[model samples]
Target: MNPYKEIENEILNASHILITAHKSPDGDSVGSSLGLLHFIERLGKKAVIGHPDPAPEFLQWLEGIDSILYMERDGEVLKNHFQKADLIFCLDYNATDRVGPEMQQLLKSTSAKKIMIDHHLNPENFVDITVSATEVCSTAQLIYELIEQSGHADLLSEKIGTALYLGILTDTGSFRFPSVQPRTHEILGKLLGAGVSHHLIHEQLNDNNTVARLQLQGYAMSEKLEILDSCHAAIISLTEAELTRFKAQKGDTDGLANLALSIKGIRIAVCLYEKEGKIKMSFRSKGQENPVNILAEEHFDGGGHANASGGISELGMDATLKKLKTLLPVYYKSDK
Candidate 1:
């Protein structure tokens, strides 16, 4: 029996549906949620999209993005939808904590049947139906597969196709990541057939950067980047003052960590930025030399994929940098 058959049945039975993604919602999370929203509406069912926080400004151009309720800003509206929802679809995240504390509590208290469609490792068993495919490139790919396999291909509109395409493009690093496969290209073809403009999407996501954002990137590379040649590691730290000086926005430093990773000898790249009184860290590594997720989980109290992970430290910027430098030798040994 096809697993998606169960998912289809659940959707058929549901009337009032609610969709949500993790906090600090990225392209994949927001795109998959909106794509699924369009899918649900095509089924003649009413669905509401919610997120723990607002999406980045770049994603606001997506169709139906304005309708997504931010749980942090619109608690009552989200709570009301949560109460009335017959089914909830959780996209792109595994754990309830990924939705933040208040929304996590609401999710736990809700009686609605939950469905999870994610492409992440170690999913928590909190949902009724779990479609956790870590092998897939992104949750958007899984959604496209679900729709194609379940014989609902005709329900896909240009808006839905564009959202799905954005998710795949960004999450796979514009088809540069190893996770991308031939099937990903096939899906891209289908999305293109559905009228998604690839060039426009690329321009919107990448070319629409502000001058302040470019200045922030320049300052980070020149002034903040620190290299450990012996360990082949690079670290970048940005203080709140620096961010304010450049008028940094939510997505300003989106791909800044990758800049460090691009260095010739840098095997491990770490970006630490102060935000809201906490030091937020993003770890990126090349190949399988070092599993950044393990290091992040063990020391930084956070985890994600092997190559890419994020964590937070309550300590100040200086202390966090010192701690990271101290641990660098342990993870990236001189011999290795």
Candidate 2:
């Protein structure tokens, strides 16, 4: 319990602080970065966020998002911050390579005492102090614990709570994921007590979708969703041409895998779509019987939780689909 108070002491001593997350930032990464940024500001200190890339459009409505420095577009500004930083907080991502090439190089070169707050499995040894709890649903949860253990409960303002709440909410799939614990609810209660206005957060997250996103999702589900009756698995694939035709933006297909998994007979759901000339995959499974992380790690260059994982398919859609179908019997557990 609070061994050496390392995180607390570091925040107090560091002058130039920088926060960062992985490339193609998701809800958890965006939420945790902004949340920690707000938390540090509440301590009357200055910290800048140097994200590797832009966050999804759905999360842009959150406060302080505009201040983020992207490595792609704001290279000079981020470089300056990286050079002068005395402490770097790597959020959401584990390995240094997750930040992409240029940002990864900067992270490797920086002598700033790096502390990582992540919930991913198999954290790398790049950071000086790593607060990784794979059991926690999201990195935002770990941030809250840090705040509490640091004796800064008074600093948990509405803004900070809202940002953290978004992280925990999306990552846990609204507390439905198996990773969620009873303590998760207790932390959520504190966030609500601190005026998170969760209903509004939900609306802001889900309601502001563009018409293009709706049409794209609709087309993907109706036309692309393929059910393998033998193994009770579902798969959806979208090509680059189709994504461009609908003007699909980032986060447009965020929850489509979950949608496929909701079907009565489906136990495993896989969503593959072309992006930047590579096929990206999201795999979802129903219960403990089928763990998709193994399939993801072995077949695709990806890994995460047992139930929800990500993978990449360098092979084109046609070949990737054939390979996936061929491997389904080996990975999926049939309901015999």
Candidate 3:
């Protein structure tokens, strides 16, 4: 049988299902998972939402956000649920590896049917059924497709629609990214018809930043940012001391890449934050560069989109910059 057909049939029949996404859940991951969980629960089935990391504070107001389980200290709850689940829906990520170490182990040992819905590139080998289409802007779009295909589109409650809408809207950078397509707009229209409050979602996400985060942004611009190589690239470093001084939190540095990309000729942007004796790096490309491959293969242990990627480094800021300076020359050799 076709894998999707089998997966759909399983979804329709399964009494117990668990929903999950990649670790360090983003808007798209959290939104898609919660939206689908709510939809499944409406059918009177048992649906449990499991997250290995804390969802961002700004998105916590969405329905079913409280149902999320962060298994950092106590992961056995997730292991128990994964073991008992009849079916598992993994969204927004291309691989089980991205789901973090603890969750991945539970997924591996479970007898539960694994179905993957994502818009990323080639998937890992773990999933039993995979529906990955790189053309789509966000996994929320894929969730819409699942609801449409299940003949349950009318059951899309306002809560579900709003959650899914946040996924699509934020992942596309409010429709400013190149990934936005006709289907994205169509889905947004449908979501609006379903009574999703657009203004509320925007305000909840965009305007919910704390004063400390705003101050961190100001300090980053004034002190820590460095434009390099004729302003084709830029780097912003945030030391732990600086984080303390500004009282910044984890999500505070989320959009720092966008700030550098706003510069006239800058094509690549990087934000490095020192956290817990490790440096966390976020990379973004505004032009024709694939930062994911660079970070994944060369510098860090992570990969994401061609234009946007992130990773973690063991080296300090000075050493990392020396390596980045040496490595980045390849991308600019022709221009030089």
Q: Which of candidates 1 and 3 is the stronger one according to TM-score?
A: 1
List the candidates ranked by lDDT, beginning with the highest: 2, 1, 3
Off by over 4 Å in 3: 1-5, 288-295, 333-336
> Can you write out model 2's per-residue Cα lDDT over 201-259, one digit (the tens) per residue?
99998889888999998998899999999889999999999999999888898999999
- The TM-score of candidate 3 is 0.94
Global Cα lDDT for candidate 1: 0.90
- Candidate 1 matches the true fold with a TM-score of 0.97
Q: Candidate 3 — which pairs collide?
A: none
Per-residue lDDT of candidate 3, residues 1-336 (tens digit): 544446657877987799888887889999899888887777666688888898867778887788787778558887788878989988988877888888888888888888898987767878778888887889998888888776778888888899999999888878877788888899999999999999999999888889889999999988988888653788899989999999876588888988887777778788989999888888887644444446544568766777777788888877887877666656544263
Lowest-sum lDDT 10-residue window in model 2: 1-10
Better of 1 and 3 by lDDT: 1
Backbone clash numbers for all candidates listed: 0, 0, 0
Which runs in model 2 stand beyond 4 Å of their true positions? Answer: 1-4
Ranking by TM-score: 2, 1, 3
Local distance difference test, candidate 3: 0.82
Candidate 3's displacement at residue 24, Å, is 0.9
List of clashing residue pairs for candidate 1: none
